[model samples]
Target: MQTQTKTQFDFIIIGAGSAGATLAARLSENPEFSVCLIEAGVKDTSPFIHIPFGLAFLARLTHLGWSHNTAPQQELNNRRLFWPRGKVLGGSSSLNAMCYIRGVAQDYQRWSDAGAKGWDWQSVLPYFIKSEKQQHGASEYHGDAGYLCVDDLRHTNPLSQSFVNAAEHVDLAQVKDFNGAEHHGLGFYQVTQINGQRCSSAKAYLSNAMARSNLTILTQAHVEKIIVEQGRATGVQLHINKKTLLLKANKEVLLCAGAINSPQLLMLSGLGPKEHLADQSIATIVDLPAVGQNLQDHLDVLVQYRCKSNVSYGLSLAAIPTYVKAAYTYTFKHKGMLSSNIAEAGGFDKTEFAGEECDIQYHFLPAILQDHGRSNALGHGYGLHVCALYPQSRGEIRLLSKDPQGELHIEPRYLSHPDDQKVAIAAVRKAREILAAEDFKPYQAREVLPGAEVQTDAQILAFIRANSQSIYHPVGTCKMGLAEDPTTVVDENLKVKGMSGLRVVDASVMPSLIGGNTNAATIMIAERAADLIKQEHSSA
Candidate 1:
C-alpha cells in the first residue's frame, strides 16, 4: 500500500459546475488565493455543447450528463422520471436549454421570508447584473459587461412565434424581457449565448481565469468525501485514475456539486442525520438532519400538437436536405435553424388556481418532444410545456448505500401535495387554451396529447399522472437558513451549520425553488457567495 501525497490550496471547490466555476474564477482573481476546482466530468470541449441547437444532442450524451432517475412517485403512477444533470465543467449550464430567465423578484422575496436572510430581490439584483453581459446592454435591471452572455434567440421557429402570438391573443401581454420590470406574459426567451454559440459558465467565467497560475482545474476527479476533523472541514479525499488523494484547503472547502451530488457527498462524509448515517455503518461527525432533506423540483407536463405544415422541426427523409443546409448555415454564418434553443419562446402566466403571482411557466418547443426529446415522432409538430412554477410538494435525496460511487435515492415526490396536483391540472388546461386560441388556428392541426377527448378534470389528472416529467430544475436539498433552524444545512453565509471552514454554494442551498428557470438564480447565488467569501477573508 502506498501513502498518497496531499496537495494544498487556499480554497478547494468540489464539483466544477455553475457555482463552482464562478467561485473559482472570482476567488482566484485575487493573486493571494490559490483555488483548486475539481470536476467529475470531462472538459466542455464537445462541439455539441457549444452549438445553441445542440441541446437536443447534449441531453442524451450520458458521457457529459449525470442521467439520474428519481424513485417511483406515488402521484405519477409509480413511474420514475429521468433527470439529466450536467457532469462537465460548466455543469448543467453547459447542457441546459440556454434560456436566461432570472425568475421573478417575488421569488427572492419568498426566500428572505423563508429565512434566507439578505437574499431578497433588492439585495441579490446586483449580483444578477454582475453575472450578466446582456446583449441589450446595461439598464437599471441589467448589466453591460459581465461574463455570461445573454441575448435574444438568433433564430426562432415560425411555430414558436405563433405560440407567443396566440398567448397575446388570449390577453397575455407580450413581454419583451422576462427578467425586467414584470415577469408575466408571453415572449421569446433570451439565452446564454453569444453570436449563436452557447456561453456556459465554463466559457463565461473560466475561460479568462484558466490562464492564471493561481487557479488549477482538474477534470475527471471524483470527490469521495470531505475531510472533517475537530468540527471543521479541512480538505477533501478524491479519486483520480484509481488513486485516492487528499487535497487540503487552508481557507475553506466549498461544495458546489449541484443539488443531488452535494447532499450525497455530505452524507458520505458522515455529516447527515445520525440515524441515517449509523444505518450505513458510518461514524457520525455531525447530526445535521436536514443535510439531504427539502428536495424540490418543477414537474412539467407537455401538451403537443401536430402541425398543419412542415414548419416545425421534425425528422423525415424529406428533411435531410434541410438539415444539410442548416449545417452549412451554422458553419459559415452561425445562423438559421442550428441557432435555435428549441424551447425558444415561452411565458409566465397566472392560472385560475394561482394566487396574486403567476404560478405556471410555459416552455414552447418547435418540435414534438417525447420524453425530454429522447424519442422520435413521425410528423412535424410543436409542444407547449407547462409547469407549476411553485410547488408545495417536497422530496429528498438520500444514499442508497455507503458507497461513494453508488446510486443515490432521489425522491422528488412530484405532485405529492394536493395543491401541486390542482395547479398542475390548471396549467395543462391553460396550455390547451393557448394552443386552441384563434391566432394559432393557422398552424395548429390537432392536439396530439391529452387530446380534446381528455377534457375533464379527472382525465387531465390522469394525463398528468401518466406523462409529466421534470423540467430538469432540482434544488433545495441543502437548504440555507438560520443556525438555530434544524432543517438548515448551511447558514445565510453558506457555511455548513455546526461546522467550520466548509460551505455549500450551489442550488442545494436554495431555501426553496424559484418560480422559473434556476440557472440564472444559481449563478446569482454564486456571484453573491463569491463576494461573501472575499468579504470574510478581508475582514479576517
Candidate 2:
C-alpha cells in the first residue's frame, strides 16, 4: 500500500473559515480548478456549533476559537481585552450571534470613494443577493436559491420583541427588513439559520462541497507562513500531523486567515513593514508598509438592568421548570428557547455625530451577559449592547515575537479618538431611552449598569472606558485600496500590492468596517472574489 499526500493545487486557500469556505466551494464548482482549503482548527463537530443557543458555551470552549488577546489598551483602563476569532470551519460565523445584515449602500460607496474601484454599493449588492437563500423569497434585493440561508429567527424571546417596541416608542421607525430599502430602524434580527440550526458558512458552503473530488479540505493544519519566492507568493509552508509540508499553489495562494492572522502570516512571510520586519530579523520580501496597519473594530458597552419578569435567559434555581420545559421543546421540536440567538433584537440608527447615515448599532439580549457570558449571572435580567458603529481610532496588529506560532500584539486602540467617546456616550444614552420607554415599563427593572446616580455625560464616558468590549467585528488590518496609497496592503481586487500570485480574501482586506455584523459581508466578499478568480482562470 502506498500513502498518498496531495501537495499540489491550482489554488491554495488558507483558513477554511467564512471566505475560505465560500471560495473553496465556489472555485471548485468547475471541477477544472483544484482548490485546497486549510483550517487551523479541528472539524466543526461540536454539537454546540450547530445549536443556535449553544454560543453561550462557545466562548469558554477555547478550542473552537483563536485565543487572541490585545495588548493593554491605554484608553480602556489599560485592560487587555480577549478577542476571539473562530478556529473552526465556519470561522466566527459558527460562533457569532448569526445576525444577518448587509450594510447600507453608503458603506460600499465609502469603499469606492476610498479608491477600491469596482466595489461600490450597486456593484456589490448582486453578490449579496447571489450568496443568500432568503426565506422571504427572491426579489430585486434577495435570492432564494443560494447556499447561505437567511431567514427569520425560529425563536425570539418576548423581551426581545419588547425591545423593538420600545424603540418604536422612542420614535425609531420599525423596519420589517434591515436589508430591504431603509437601513434605519429597529426590528427582530433575521439570522443565518435553517430549521432552528445555525447555518454557519461551513454548513451553508462547505458541507455540500465536502465530497467534491476537486475540493480538498484540510483541518488541523496550521500554516507557518506563506512561501514567497522572488516577491511572488507560490505556496504555503505548514505543519500538519506533527509533520511539516510545503504545499504548492500553481496559480495563487489566497490569504483568508482574517484580520489578525492574515497580517501575522504576512509579517512572518517577510512581507510587512520594512522596519517592523527588521526588528524580528525577517528579510523584507515586499517591504509592504501597510501589511498589518489600519486595524478597526467596534467597541461595545452593555447597558444592563434586572428584569422584574422572569423571561430573560438567565440560569437560576427558580427558573428550573421553565428550563425543563425548554429542553423538552428543543429535543422534540428543535424550536424554543434553545433556538434563540441571545442578541435577538437590534437596531441601526444614526446618532447626532453621524457620518454617512448611521453611526450607532444596538443588540438587545434577553439575558445579561457578563464577561462575554463566561461568568454565570444566575438571575432574571436583560441587557442591551450599545456599540459605536464607525470608530475614528485605528490600530495595528504586530508580531509579538519572531516565532510563527507565537502570540500577536493585538491593539485595537479603542476610544483613542475623542470622537469615539462621544459616540459611545450617545449610544448608551439612546439605549437607556429605549429601555425606559412605555413598552418596557411593564417589565421595568432597576438599572444594573451605570445606575441612576450616574447621570452626567462625563460619568457615562468613564463607565464606557472602564467597561467596553469588542463586538468581534475586527477588520481593515490588510486594507484594500489603490496600489499608490501608502496605507493599502491589497488592491481593489484583493490582490496583495507589490506581491504577485497572492490575494487576501478576508475581513482583513476591508478598507473600513461596515456598519453591521461582518459575517454576511465577508461571505459576500468571498462570493465576489470567487467570481473574479473564475474570470481570471476561465481559460486555464
Candidate 3:
C-alpha cells in the first residue's frame, strides 16, 4: 500500500470499516480504478480485536470505538445511552459479537417494497453468497472462497446448550442454520471467524488488498468534510494530527462512515437540512432535508440470572484453572474458552404480537453482560439479550456546531412507539418463560435483572425502560429510497439525491434496520455496491 499522501484518486472511500474496506478491496481489483481508504483510528493491532472472546474486553476500551452517546431519551426515563461504533480499521466488525447473520428474506423484500428497487431477497442473496467463504464449503447459500470467513464456534458453554434446549422445550423449533433457510427458530449462531480468530472486514478484505499498488490506506486520518463544488462531491478534506489536507476523487467520493459519522460528515459538508445548517452558520450546498433523519436501532433488553456453579465465564477463583488452561490452549492452538465469542449462542423467535416472522431475537451469553460487557464479571452468571427486530420509533443524528470537529448527537427515541413497546414487553415475558424452562434444571438459578418480585407486565415494562440499551446495530440515518420520499438521502443506486459523483456506501443507506446483526448485511451492501460502481463506470 502506498502511504505517501496523494492529492487525487479514482475513488475516495471514507471510513475504513466493514463496507469501506470491502469496497476498497473489490473496487481496486479492476485495476482500472485507484482507491484510497481513509480511517480515523489506528490499525486493528489489538490482540483483543483478533481473539474472539476479547470482544467483551474490547467493549470497555473506548479508544477502539466512537465514545458518542445519544441525547437523553425521554422515553427511557431521560437516560443517555452510550453507542460504541468501531473507529478502527475494520470498524465495528472488529468489535462486534461476530454473529454472521444476513437477516431473513423479508428484510430485503421490505427494502425493495419501500422504494429501494432491485434490493429484494432474490436480488441480494447472490451478493451475500459472493462475499462469504463458509467453513462448511460451497452450497446454494454459502461460498467456499470469498473474502469473509464464516464458521461454527469452536467452544460453547454448557449453559448455552441448555438455552438451546430450553428453546426447543418451549416449542421453538431447532434451527440447524440461522442463515440456511430462515431465521425463524432457535440455534447457535455462526460467527465471522477463521480458526477461532475473528475474520474482521479489515482482515478479510483489506489485509491483502493493502499490498496492492492501486490501493492506498490512510490510518488515523479523520475526514472533516466532503468537498462539494457546484453540487458535485469532488473529494474530501481531512485532518491528520494538526495538519489539514485535501484529497480529490476523480470519479466518485464514497462515504462509508457508518451511521452516526456518515450523516455528520454530510451535514458538515453543507448538505443537510438548510435551516439546521443555517443555525450552525454552515453554507448549504444542497438543501437535503432528510440527510440525518430516519435513524433506527435495535433497543435490547437483557435478562440476567445468577449461576449457582462456576459454569459461566465469570471472574472467580474456581475459573482460574479453567482460564489458565484456556490461555495455554489459545496461546498455541487458538482453541478453547478464549476462542468463544462471549455471546456464544443465540436464536430468533416471535411473540404473539409479531406477524408471520419472528419479532424478537435472542443472544445467549454464558457470562453476565454488564453495560455491553464493559464491566468485569464479578460473579458466576448468565444472561439473555432480547431485542425487538423492527422498531417503529425513529431518531436523528444532529450536529452541535458547524466546526468539522463538533459533537454529533444521536437521538434514538427508543420505545417511543407503542408497537415497539408492545414488542419489547412481549420479548421480556417470552425470555422469562424460556429461562424458567425444564432444560435449565441443572443450572437452576434466580433471576438477577427483573427479579421474581418483578413479574407483572407493567413492572417488566418499567424495568425495560430503565435497563434496555442499543444492540449496536444503528442504521438508516441517510435512508435509501426513491427521491419522492421526503426522508430519503440516497436513491436505489445509493447515489445522493440530486448530487453527482458521490454516494453513501454504509449502513446509513439502509432504509430500515435488518432482522439481525448488521455487519453481514453491510458487507453484502459493499459487494453489491462494488458491482454497481463497476457496471456504472464501465458503461460511462
Candidate 4:
C-alpha cells in the first residue's frame, strides 16, 4: 500500500465543534499564522441545519451525530443509555436545542478554588459576555457586540407560560435572567439563534473566517492518533478518503475533539496511563492516569403532565401557523416564533440543600417529552425536566482495542451514586409539586408519566431509575487544574501538563459540568484558551 503525503501547519486543531471552530477562527485572525482544522464529519450544509425547529429531526441523526452509547449502568439494571453528540461542523452546538445559558457565577469560582488559576467567575465572565451579542440591551454581564447572537424566544406556547407560572406558584421565585448576578429562580431561556435560524458554531465563528486564505479546513478527516515525538506533540495521523495522511504541526497541536474523543486520542497516541497503554502494546509517552477518568454528566428526569386545555405541543397542526408566523417574522423582519428555541423557558434553583449556590436546573418544555424515541400525546401537554446540576458519579473512557480506529468504551456510570439518584428523585418530586400548583390548574389536566396512581416515593424512585436520561452535558474527562491534582489533565493555561506543544481546549477540560446549558460555557472556554495560546506564543 502506498503511504500518503504529509502536510504541516502552525497550529492543528482537531474536531470543528463549538470549541474547535471558535478557537480556529480566533487564532486564525492573524494572517501570519497558518491553521489547519480537521473535522471527522462533513460540512454543515443541510437546509434543515439552519432551522431552529429542525433540531428534533437532527437529534437521532447518525451522519451528523456520533450517537455514543454508555456502557450499561449497573444501577439501572445495566441499561446502556444513548448519548448523541454532534459529529458535524458545529458539533453538539449544531444539533443541540440551542439554549444559551452561562450557568451560575460560582461554577467558575469552584474551578479557581480547585486550582484552575485565573478561571474564577470574575475573570471568565468577560469571555462569556464577549462571546454573546445579546439581542436585549447590554448589561454588566452581557454584551451586544459579539460573534454569537443571543436572542429571546419568540413563540412561547401558553402551556409554557403556565409552566413558568406554576414554578412561581410553587414558591420557586421568578427570575428574569439566569445569567445575571442571581441565578436562582424561574425565567425565560435565551437561545443561540439569530432571526429564525440556529447560530451554530459554524454559523457563528467559522462562517466569518471561512474565506481566510491562511486557514485550511478539512472535512471527513478522521484522526487516528496524535503524532507525538520525543515527548513533544507534533501533529496527527488521519484517514481521509480511505488513505492515511500525516499532518505535522509547526508550532502547536490543539485537541478540541471533545471529552470522549480527546482522551481516547491521547490513549491511542500512547499519552495515557502507562499500564493501560502497555496492555494494548503501545509505548507510553505520558503516564497520565487520570486522562480518561473523572467523567461527569447531568441526568435529567422529564416530569410530563397532560393539559386540560388544547394548548399542548400535540397541537402541532394548529401550531404550524404559529411557526409560520414566526418564520415570516424572521424571514422579513429578523424576529418571531421561528427564532424561538424549542425549550422556550426555564430557570435555576436550589433544593434547600444549604448550598451557597443553586444546584438544580430545569428545562421547561411546552410539549410531552415523556416518550424516549417518540411521543403519543392525547392532548395539550408539557414537560418539566429536573436536572441535577452537580453530579458525583464519576465514569471513565477506556480503549476497547489498540487500533486507533477501534471503538472506545465509555462507562458514564449514570446514577451510580445513591446521592445522584436521591437528588434526581427529589428534583422530580419538586417538579410534581410544581405541576400540582394552581398556576397549572388552568392548563394541566392530569399526571401522565408517573400517573395519579403512582404517588409513593418508592414508585417515583423506580420510575426515575428506569426513565432518567442525560441532558447531553458531558465533561471533566480531561479535566483542567494544577499539575498536582490527580484528575487534572491540563493546567490553568489549558496546556497538557506532562506534554509540550499540546493543549486540550474544549468541554473536556472543564473540571466539572456547569449549572445549565454547557454550549455557551464551552464556547467561552475556547475564547479564553485562544488568548492563552496567543499569549504563550507571543512570549515564546
Cα lDDT computed for each candidate against the true fold: 0.90, 0.90, 0.90, 0.83
Candidate 4 residue spans exceeding 4 A from truth: 1-6, 315-337, 370-379
Question: Lowest summed-lDDT stretch of 10 residues in model 3?
Answer: 1-10
- How well is each residue in 225-274 modelled by candidate 1, as lDDT tens digits? 99998998999999987798899999999999999999999999999999
Candidate 2 on 229-348: residue-level lDDT in tens? 887889999988888889999999999999999999999999999999999999888889988889999999989999778878888877899879988998899898898988899988
Model 3 C-alpha lDDT per residue in residues 114-134, reported as the tens digit of each score? 999989999999999999999
TM-score, cand. 1 vs. native? 0.98
| C-alpha TM-score for every candidate | 0.98, 0.98, 0.98, 0.94
Across residues 1-540, which tens digit of lDDT does each residue of candidate 4 receive?
223343988999999999999999999998878899999998998866787766546754569888788888887767788788888999889988898888877789889988999999889989998888899868998998889988877667776677677765777777777788776778788788876688999899999798998888988889999988887998899998898889999899999999889999989988888988888888888899999999999988888877666665555466667557766777786565445566888887777552887778888877665334333444467788889898889999999897766777889888888788777777877777777777777664777777777677788888887887888988998999998887788999988878899999999999988888899999999999998888777534
**Model 4: how far residue 209 lies from native, Å:** 0.4
Error of 4 at 139 (Å): 2.3
Error of 4 at 133 (Å): 1.0
